[model samples]
Target: MTDGVTAAHGTGGHGEPADAPVSAWVLGADSGGSGLRITLAAVPEGGAPQTVGTVTSTEPVRTGAQGIDAEHMLAQLVPAARELLERAGERAQAAGLRSVCVGAAGMATLGGQLRAELPAALTREFSVRRIALAADAVTAYAGALGQLPGAVVAGGTGLIAMGTDLRNWRRADGWGHLLGDCGSGAWIGQAGLQAAMRAYDGREGGSAALRERAEAVFGAPLSGLPAQLYPRTDRPAVLASFAPEVAACADRDTAASEILRAAAQEIATAAAAVCPAEEGVSVAVTGGLFRIGEPLLAPLREQLHRRAPHAHLTEPAGDPLDGALLIAARLSSDALRLPQDPALLSLT
Candidate 1:
């Protein structure tokens, strides 16, 4: 940890204490389509850390809106995250916090976009060093499986598949909202919208489950959906928010069911691409899409199993924030060691 001078770099309610001991503070951040999440944990060597707390913020990107540039999204999000870290540090100070670690979206892949930009943003706001950044998927992958080599599929506002061979790593399908996020929430919503459009055109002769659900939830008629959905800043949510209703209609409506089935296929394909064809790979599913239950996971698992017979499946042990903290704990001059904390055990 840095001296109080470095810790006192930014202006919040209170600066760092002159006499505070420099301990380990673990912070993880997930800046996804829905919003932003910051988790803080206080870890002492060989000791279990008491939960400090979590700070929730918003992603710079609007849930469903299009046309907003990446720069604009980062501008809005970077400040919120900085404020969150400062806030967490202050809270940890009140509760006794010393070091911090962060796991956030864009941290891993959005290099010029997030890596350099974020560190500068933080330093401008606070005196912080020892920051470790990785793909949000890394946190999820690590959190779900600990140091073991495995693959994780996240189907949320965006879809991304990643895996580590415990040595080598690979990833695919994080195309964002425009090109293709194959197995993402955006994909599901977009597919659902297509189904609705087809139904409206009479090209398809069934009630479009996605369209009906969107109408029910947003109180917006299906006829005017594109107009309402496209012009707004939160298009992803406007579309994805209907996910539950789509799931409900999947069994009863062919169009809706087909959309879900297609999503499962895409996810399975991504999983296969990330994992080796050889047996014994571990795979796990997480994110908002899986929360919808069997409508998604069951089909996805079945498809993956058919492709890779020896793969193992498991539920996420802890959230990605925990994974971020776990990553921080592992980053060392040499190698990371397991802490005595029980809460952290789940992360590994």
Candidate 2:
């Protein structure tokens, strides 16, 4: 909480009261499958931006549920944002908290009561005059490309590819785990688990090491796999957890290596789907997949070369939290003029 610490270090003057308006700062947050990331910066009149606070907290995963689950999702999001608001203290009233922008995982598919609920909660809590809500992938692209005309592949628990060249914009994948999200962590994990089950039954000529690993995790014969998954609320995360193990075993297990190689291909193909194979476009790669290094990246690099050789590939300039801030800034000016999508909620 950078801003909180700085505010606390200020003069002996009293802090802003809880009931006052937060009018001087802009906040950006990334809400994802596992957690929430928030960053705040104060924009004083005619002065350089001063970063004040940032926070990371756990939150519910959005699995594309449209009704009651959407309310439940808001139930999780409000508290994380509230924590940041409270950090601003009475200074929220003094500095006069301004606008907030939030990017969540399934925002592209968002609608219904949940969409309406989030902005109301933010306004009431932070007393900000304006709010912007967008798909985390939108911010991811902006943050990764620095708002340049390029494409970005965001590979985390799920996967999505988005690209823009001012004149046109395109998006691909991000269909979620049930139908798509190929080359995502959940996708790789599912592939590994299926291979393990096949080896257990001698069905796929799978790797013994993979089978042994599964047995060790799920008990002998692995008969309890369904029991482990069926009753859990966080089934996707549970399944996606296996991806790290798959990547770890890729060097010693054939099935694991094949799963990673295949996952890489699928993700690369997704990137190519949204980005044209042109000479001028540059693509940035982000998310946990990049963190796994060569085991996954080697194949992805090869696939990208083969699939979209004319496009350039590079590391992201910043994470999604940064994207949130970048877009919020854009909204204030006409910077890159983000397109209006129904999934996005803009309150001013």
Candidate 3:
């Protein structure tokens, strides 16, 4: 048995020798605004793969003129991969990496460089043959529903909804904070802040509760907020940090409650837009934005019922990292069923 590799069904048991050779290794990675996570798993001869090691980095990959900086991602990923391989012992490393699946937040629109370079780069680094570079939304769908006919709304600082019927992918409202992502945490926070500003100006449609919360969070004389907020590169995440304040004030503030309700409507509408019309298709809402809890979820449930009544609301089975691993496993076993796309789920 390898030092770090866990024995799977066909190795060291079930009539197989303890020294049974590993067939291959697969790598799964999820990269997003927050950071990057990589998982290494080993597949034994005629056995399912088991996770051997994992690594995470808090620094997100940088974006440059060409889009997501492939070099930057590789800089973080290669070392981590090497560390995992070394930990897995000689036998597991000898099998080598056979396939890789990387799910990145901007892979659909901002992954030109990744698509153009990642496959060849990975090939050089690990001799990888099969690779799936996917948009985070697609991975979120796979994570939530596992290739089943369903809709998945992933809402964090930004939001996107995706659905598939095993034929093609449908997407909605991932246009970032400036254009869409209507039901996202940033949206809610921006709305809450607007209400707070309105109250400061003695205007209509203002919430005193939100105003107090905002002032408490951002400091007094809220007019100074722009100076504090506008210069940062991570404006979306900063804005989203206020979403919980809105949720916290929902019980006692009419404006806050209304903001959440409207946000829910937008999210449900996005979900419905991508959801298969067939009855019983699963719908899942995933990500940190949903953690605002019943204040947001209760309204979201009601809105989903109204908008996607034929769809069954389901809890997410896993997250994007799990989805990437699932895709890698399927690719390794030659059982991948998700439809291929140029931008959303590119295969090589």
TM-score of each: 0.71, 0.78, 0.90
lDDT by residue (209-253, candidate 2, tens digit) is: 777777777778777797888798877777788888888899988
Q: Sort by lDDT, best first.
A: 3, 2, 1
Model 1 lDDT, full chain set:
0.60
The digit string of per-residue lDDT tens for model 3 on 1-348 reads 112323222211134454556677888899987789888877656654467777888788898888999989988888888888888889768878889999998898899999999999999999888999999998888778876898999999999999888899999998989999898999999999999999999999999999999999999999999999999998988889999999999998999999999999999999999999899999999999999989989999999999989998999988887788778877887888889999999999
Ranking by TM-score: 3, 2, 1
lDDT of each: 0.60, 0.70, 0.87
Q: Give the TM-score of candidate 2.
A: 0.78
Candidate 2, residue 142: how far the Cα is off, in Å:
2.3
Per-candidate Cα RMSD to the true structure, in Å, reads 8.9, 6.3, 4.4
Off by over 4 Å in 3: 1-24, 43-49
Error of 2 at 182 (Å): 0.8
**lDDT of model 1, residue 273:** 80
Top candidate on TM-score is 3
